[model samples]
Target: MKKLEIACFTIASIKIALENGANRIELCNQMEVGGTTPSHEMVTEAAKYDLLKYAMIRPRGGNFVYSTEEFESMKKSLLDLKEQAIDGFVFGLLTEDFQVDISKNKELIQLAHPLPCTFHRAFDQVIEVKQALEDCITCGFQNILTSGLKQTAIEGKEILQALIQQANNRITIMPGGGIRSSNIEELDRFVQANWYHSAAITDGSNTANAEEIQNLKQKLHA
Candidate 1:
C-alpha cells in the first residue's frame, strides 16, 4: 500500500500525525523556510512517540549549499539525533553550481550508517535531475523527497512518473511539495509513487490538521 508521510513542524503536529494514523513523519522546525533541524529537546520529546520518525538535518533555510561550518553543524545534528529514537535522517547538499555535493552527502550518509537517509527537497534545485538522482543513490540515500523540480507535485506529475520509471525500484522517489488530500488522488493517478508527503496544514498554520492527515492517508489507500 502507499504510505503518507507528514511534514510535522511541532510536537503538536507529531501528535496529530500519530492520532490520525499517518504512516510516518518528517520532524523538523521552521516550516516557513521549508524545514530545519529540530532541537535536541524536540527530538528527545518526539522520540517518546511510537511512530516512525525521520529527523531533518538541515542547519539553515536559505539554500542547499553550505559553508564548512554549516556542513559541520549538519554532521553534529545527525550524530546527536542518531542517539535518539529516530528511524532515519533527511538531508541534502549541493555545490554552488547546483550539482550534488556527492562527497559531503556521502559523508553524512555514512555517519547515518545502518539507518537510512532521505535526500530532501534540495534535489529540486539540482541542474540535472537524472544525474542528481543517480548521485543520491550513489551517496547511499534510500529515498529522495522532491517535487520533480516543479513547484508542486501535480504540476510535475509527468516528470515524477518518468523518475519513478527511471528509478526502477533502485531508489524510492517520494513525491512531496504541495501534496494534500484535495489533489492527492489526481497526482497519484499519474505519478503512482510508493510514498507521498505533505504538511497537511489546511488552515495555514504550522500544525497539521488531523482530519487532513487522515484524509490524505485514506485517499492513498483508496
Candidate 2:
C-alpha cells in the first residue's frame, strides 16, 4: 500500500498527525523559517508516539547555506540526538554558490551514524540537477525530498517524472511542498512514489484543528 507521511511543526501537530493515520512524522521546530532542527525534548517526546519520527537537523532558518560554526553546531546536534531511539533525521547543506556542500553534509551524516539520512529540499538549490542526484547517491543519502526545482511538486510533475525515472531505485524521491488533500489524487496517480509528505493544518492560526486533521487523513486514505 502507498504510504503518507506528514510534516509536523510542533508537538500539538505531531499528535494530530498521528491521530489521523499519518504513518510518519518529520519533526521540526520552526515552520515559518521553512523548518529547523527540533529540540531534544521534542524528539524524545515524539519517540513515545510509536510512529516513525525523523527530526530535522537544521541549525537555523534562513537559507541552506551555513557558516562553519553553524555547520559544526548541526553536527553536534546530530551527535546529541543519535543517542535517542528515533527513526531517522532530515537536513541539507549547500555552499554559498548554491552547490552541494558534500564535505559538510557528509560530516553531518556521519554524526547521524546508524540513523537513515534524508537530503531535504536544499537539493533544489544545486545548479546542476543530475550531478546533484549522483552526488547525493554517492554520499549515502537514503532519500531526497524535492519539488523538481518548481515551487510545487504539481507544477514540476514532468521534471519530477524525469527525476524519478533517473533515480531508478538508486534512492527514494519524495515530493513535498504544496501537497494537500485537494491535489493529492492527481499526485498519487502521477508520482507513484512509495511515500509522500504533506502538512495538514487548519483554517485557524494556532493549535492543531481536529476536524481539518481528520479530513486530511480521510482524503489520504481515500
Candidate 3:
C-alpha cells in the first residue's frame, strides 16, 4: 500500500499527524526556510511518542552545501539524535557545483548505521538526476525525497515517473515538495511512487491540519 509521510515543524503537528493517520513523519523545524535540524529538546519530546520518525540532520537551511564547521555540526547532531528514539536520519550534502558529495554522505550514512537514511530535497538541486540517484544509492541512502528536480511533484510528475523506473527498486523515490491530497491521486496515477510527502499545512500555519492529513491518508489508500 502507498504511505503518507508528513513534514512536521512542531510537536503539535506530530500529534496531529499520528492521530490523523500519517504513516510516518519528517521531523524538523523552520519550514519557512525549507527545514533545519530540530532542537535536542524537541527531538527528546518527540521521541516520547510512538511513531516512526526521521530527524532532519541539516545544520542550517539556506542550501545543501556546508562549510567545514557546519558539516561537523551535522555529524554531532546526528550522533546526538541517534541516541534519541529517532527511527532514521534525513540529510543531504552537495558539492559546490551541485553534485552529490558521495564521500561525505556515506560517512553520515555509516554513522547512522543500521538505521535508514533519506537524502532530502537537496536532490532537486543536483545537475544530473540520474547520476545523483546512483550516487545516493552508493552512499547507502534508503530513500530519496525529491520533486523530480522540479518545484513541485505535480509539475514534475513526468520526471518523477522516469526516476521511479530508473531507480528500479534500488532506492525509494519519495515525491515530496508541494504534495497535497488534491493532487496526490493525479501524481500517483502518473508516478506510482510508493511514498508521498507533504506538510498538510492547509491554513498557512506552522502546524499541520488534521483534516488535511486524514484526507491525504484516506486518498492514498482509496
Best by lDDT: 1
Q: Candidate 1's residue-wise lDDT over 36-116, tens digit each?
A: 999777788788889999999998899999999999988998998898899999999999999999999999999999999
Which ranges in model 3 have alpha carbons more than 4 Å from their true place? none
Question: How many Å off is the CA of 104 in candidate 1?
Answer: 0.3
The model with the greater lDDT, 1 or 2, is 1
Q: Which residue pairs overlap in candidate 3's backbone?
A: none
Output the lDDT of residue 9, model 1.
Answer: 93
Worst 10 residues of 2 by lDDT: 201-210
Task: Write one digit per residue (lDDT tens) for candidate 3, span 1-222.
Answer: 999899989889988988998899999988888999997777877787898999999988788889999989999999989988999999999999999999999999999999999999999999988999999999999999999888999988888999999999999999998888899988998999999999999887899999999889888888
lDDT of each: 0.92, 0.80, 0.92
What TM-score would candidate 2 get against the native? 0.92
For residues 105-187, write the lDDT of model 2, one tens digit per residue.
88777777778899999987788988888888877899999887888988877777778889999999988877767787787
